[model samples]
Target: MANIRPYKISISESQIQDLKTRLSLSKFPDELDNAGWDMGAPLADIKRLTRHWESSYSWKTAEAELNSLPHFITDIQCDGFQPLAIHFVHIRSKVQNAIPLLWIHGWPGHFWEGVKIMKPLTEGDGVEHPAFDLVVPSLPNFAFSEGTKERGFALAQYAETLNKLMLKLGYNEYVTQGGDWGTHISRALAHLYPQTCKATHLSMDAANPPSFLANPVLTLQHMLTPYSKREREGQSRTEWFTKEGRGYNLEQSTKPQTLGYALVDSPVACLSWIYEKLHDWTDNYPWTDDEVCTWVSIYWFSVAGPAASTRIYYETHHTTRTPENPRAVPRDMLRAYSPGVKLGYSHFPMDLVVLPSTWVRTLGNVVFERDHEDGGHFAAWERPGELVKDLRDMFGKKGGAFGCVKGANGYSQ
Candidate 1:
């Protein structure tokens, strides 16, 4: 597995030039008159982003910033075959009190999402705060990691890979925090490896109901609540996407070969697809045009586009994540008014998670629950300090229970 050929970014001046050329020449879609994002990625906004991407963006600068941290690549046996190598960033907190913390990003963002919190977390912001030896990994194929050849890349698939990553690095025990898909991964990890994965936390820890949560009247009440706004508006913008946002997913699960062509061939197309989501999903806080472009540019240079993200989507929808064997560890859940942004962006259909508490109860122990005054979908990227601070406090408490094997009662089964 160590011999799985290492791969780093190889974007050249010429490749950047060609990417710019394509962005400059690409034909855009016809819009409804006076239509803006109500149609999807307003033409004017897309043009503005395209112009900046073509003229002023520099991949080299971003590459250096990314390389400032330590990075490595290695393969973890997913099952029978030697799949694509996992690219990860490991930043160890020098503080003697540091707790082992592993952060995961799902779709939309890459390992880059967790970069902001690295220094403040590990460097010990204050005088005597314990540092966190961080293990931030790019989910297989989202950014720098290689694509998997497995049939589907679901939460279970990721859980398997992560288990190997921890053991490979001699981390028999660790703590995890995540938001979107990362949140799901955390749950799966806790359920699958309750012993090694000491505790789990999620910003979106809503569970699916037996079918009553979708009753017409109850669903209507959820829609009006502004909390489920994003999904509601998401469905309106992209008619097909609202049905679980499965357009790209279908291709990834069935014909990844065909989907890879468009993503690989047109760099601009990939950016347009992914960048729009960052804007559409988040509550649209702590992100500006420049930051948004930076995230998208990373993908362009890394060339870890449509294929990898699609695999995540394919793997998630196809995997067996839901089970009766309830999670045994404690969980901390934060609901950061994410639904409002999804609704305000456009009228897309949303799976409004009305009661995250009741939902999370099905999976595992939920110790802490707070509706964060700030942040939305990408909490780590949007509010790194707060997210890291919460993690530190939570992990600090977990450290207090270092030797205790069972979760404190009244948490979860």
Candidate 2:
């Protein structure tokens, strides 16, 4: 058994100096007249951010703040993969039998995204609401966690690593919340370990329209019901993503190695690459320069380097299964329903993949669903209170998934 040890964020002084040196030497490109977001991250915004990142931002202070969180590291050995050191934040609630919940993050996002909700989740109002013993892992390559060297370490491997980590922590049963790649990973866990992962709550909705062959009742319902105003608008948003915003997806999925060079070498290139999504993906969240730099800094100082994170796209895209011998839990199967685990969804208006209620219903035995008036891709960061509230309600006394994990009702006697 791998031992769990407390961890801290402590970047070297020389490394910080080196980062400044790189930022100081950044060279930006010329922009067309009035070329706002229609083109990409604007030059003016990038320039201002770069200037601040070089001169004003203090990574030392940022590092200290991150260090204050309850962080830990443990080795998790997947079946075929070598044991790798995994970093995570684990906060337990005082409420007796508080539910154990795993919060997973995706590409361009690290475990810090859970910082805002950590307190609220673990310290719910004792009388009425539910509390959680939160476990937020920095997915293998994305942050402090070590990355794998072998290829084909796709979603299944990611899911297995996390499941083992949870079990290692003595959380025999738990619930989950995720967005972006996290949504897929959490679903994979639910599919592979239905007994262990009792329920899931997702901010990003990724599911197909119910099929006549598989879900005739749902297909009929989907066909008969008129699209809500929100659903119609959601289609337009999704279309915009497909037509205008998926260039990164193509690059990351097809040739991450080629793009990795630019990302690894140039701080400005990495900044602009992530900054564009931070700007376009959110619903006009007023981001401070420090906020932008802090986010990018994680990628810049990531354990496996930024390039390693993008390989998941290629691996997932290239996953293939033969008819004679099917994969135990196929990637596409995560999109369909898993019978045992209860599911919940929270739909943010400006999220990348905004689907209708009927379509999302096909993902699982959905017991709770909520559509917010405003929010975007990074829901926990942009709207922490709302997201935490949804989790509390989902597992509270009257919730559909209440007591889903034995002895963890998250309430005071």
Candidate 3:
């Protein structure tokens, strides 16, 4: 493995200027009082967030912080012709003999979830995770990493990219964690290279596929009761979300270009699109306005929103889709106490779900499941401290545990 090279973030002044120019030029349509998000970004909220993004948010601070953490870009050759260059932050354990941990993030979010975890992993002194080293990367076309230049950039290919990344790092064995697309891709990694990925932790999952025609794995309580308390409040909200959220999902998968205008044109639109997801997933528990800005800032200054979400959709949509090998690996679920999507659901709670190859064969051992008292889909950001603790504890105790982390109590055992 090459000695880790020092890398700097590449956000240009011109790009920032272009973004501001675009935001300044935004021609918002006139909206009557109480006219809501039915059209898209709410005028009231978008105006407020745009004002802050243009005036107060500092890209340099975030960029420097990202730079302070170890970062690198390396290529992996596969179905994708050009050696795929992946962007990652490798946080070495302050103490020697740290375990190596690979973290993959979902769409609409980057490595930022795992990027800032090293400090907590090392317990303020970087002395912890002595048994672990952290690797967090932005998926192709998402962040700094360029998307595949070739014709075959599928989710499975992305898993292979991860495999090469691990081998390149000289790690024959390591653990993994993810949610959303990360959940499926990590599963693909384990299935593609189980020897290299010893065990994986996921933040989204359920028991394996239906065991019988009549009796499924789902519990009566689960089927009868709402997925979460907040969901039971109203069926109308659930219906509205289904109708609306599906449009975004379908467009992203089928016709990403259709929605690109608003997202690609206005920084305000871009921020709203992503921020709303984060806000909803975390149950919108009154986050600090700046708390919302950090995520938007990453997408804004980097100028990587519309395309980032689309590429993931593109790759996932076009991947090795077939009946012979429907899914690649097992997914563990870490259910957040109150997530918005859970509020809007019928049978399936998530949007894009892929079952594994061993899905029907090994139901019991495959899916690791757990529920948390706090946090939702964006666990890493909303509840980093808790996320870290759970990750350590889960992995540490797994006589066959999937994901593990411990906070003040210590996951080191």
In the range 1-413, model 3's lDDT, one tens digit per residue, is: 57445567878888878867776777666778887656666778877877776777666676777677778878767652576567788876654445567888887778886754657765433223224578887777677776654544666667887877877887666767777777677666655665666666666542343333423443333355444433333234445556665566667877766677767667776777786676555544566666567666666554244555576565466555358545422223212111111010111222223222223123223333333454556656666666676655554444234222222112343
With candidate 2 superimposed using the best TM-score fit, by how many Å does residue 222's alpha carbon deviate from the native? 1.3
User: Tens digit of lDDT per residue, candidate 2, span 1-413?
Assistant: 45999998888889888889999999989999989897999999999998999999999999989999999999998877798999999999998788899999987788987789999989976568898999999998888999999987888889999999999999999999999988999898988889899999999988888899988998999999998767888998999999999999999999999999999999999999999999899998999888899999999998898898899888888776667424434667778788899999999989998998988888889989988889999999999999998998888887888888998875634
lDDT of 1 by residue, 97-162 (tens): 355667888766778888888888777632334456688888876677766655645566687788
lDDT of model 1, residue 78: 74
TM-score per candidate, chains pooled = 0.76, 0.97, 0.77
State the TM-score for model 2: 0.97
Top of the candidates by TM-score: 2
Error of 2 at 100 (Å): 0.5
Regions more than 4 Å wrong, model 2: 322-330
Q: How does candidate 1 fare on TM-score?
A: 0.76
Q: How many steric clashes between backbone atoms does each model show?
A: 17, 0, 21
